[model samples]
Target chain A: GAGVSQSPSNKVTEKGKDVELRCDPISGHTALYWYRQSLGQGLEFLIYFQGNSAPDKSGLPSDRFSAERTGGSVSTLTIQRTQQEDSAVYLCASSPTSGTEAFFGQGTRLTVV
Target chain B: AQRVTQPEKLLSVFKGAPVELKCNYSYSGSPELFWYVQYSRQRLQLLLRHISRESIKGFTADLNKGETSFHLKKPFAQEEDSAMYYCALGGGRGSRLTFGEGTQLTVNP
Candidate 1:
């Protein structure tokens, strides 16, 4: 079965520019997540979506960070006016539901220059 | 707030030697703990969860409420066991996880 897929394996953009990272969860998976991994750091939870439930966005570092999942399958994380601090690997994951083993993507390395 | 701490940034053990990766966590209530592993060039994956109370690939972990710890252990480490290990805490009904900085294990054969 296909696991979580993230597009744009790597991205380099200027500061203040907007960037959108995409994620495709496994077929039938109802839970999706976005996380950030800085250099030599742990995974920072960003957002979560489970079924038709309200998504959890408390982990977003700032208002510039936002995400939306359409049709409960594909998700996109948008960073408005990206900062150099946003340079990190963006990871996406999906599971059958909360508490299940979540499958992760290879991650998209975003570099805000 | 929930947090997981992996004190050791790196661990090295010879093949066939015992290995233990320390993990400590803090949460006000009953917490769910997990171990996630990522090999070089591979995606991160779940290694085990404390609730399952099951061993995978000769590795096991026991959650200690008294100590607020969930350390991973293996009787004899193998070369293939070398990888980055992350301690995570799953919180609330959403199951969002708080992770540690991760420890890179090196099994020298």
Candidate 2:
């Protein structure tokens, strides 16, 4: 079976620019999540989506970060006015449901210069 | 707030030697504990969960409520086991995971 997939394996952008990272979850997966991994740091949860419910944005670092999952499938993480501190690996994951083990994507390495 | 803690930033052991990766967590309620592993060039994946009570790749972890820990252990380490290991905690119905800083395990053969 196909696993979760993310686009733009690596991205380099100047500070103050905006970038969008895509994620395609495995078929039939109803839950999606986004996280960020900084050097030598743990995975920082960003947002979560389950079915048609409102997404959980508690972990989002700031108002500039947002995400959307359409048709209960594809998801996109957008960072507005990127900062050098935002440089990190953006990871996406999906699960059969809220409590199941999650399957992750290769991640998009975002670099802000 | 829920949190997962991996005290050691790195662990090294020779092949066939015993291995233990300590993980402690703090949460207000009952939490689900998990161990996730990421091999070089590979995506992060689940190694084991405390609920399953099963070992994967010769690794096992026990959930201790008294100590609030879920430590991964292997009787015999393998060179292939060299990778980054993260301990995670899931609480609430949404099942969002809080991860630890991670431990880089280097198994020497």
Point to the candidate with the largest lDDT: 2
True contacts kept of each: 0.54, 0.54
Number of the top DockQ candidate? 2
All candidates: TM-score: 0.87, 0.90
- In model 2 chain B, the worst 10-residue window by lDDT is B90-99
The lDDT for every candidate, in the order shown, is 0.90, 0.91
lDDT of 2 by residue, B25-62 (tens): 99988888889999987889999999999999999999
Predicted candidate 2: interface RMSD? 2.0
Best by TM-score: 2
Interface RMSD score of each model: 2.2, 2.0
Query: How far does residue A90 in candidate 1 sit from its true spot (Å)?
Result: 0.5
DockQ of each: 0.55, 0.58
Please give, for residues A1-113, the per-residue lDDT of candidate 1 as tens digits. 56788998999999999999999999998888899988877678899899899999988999999999999989999999999999999999987877466789999999999
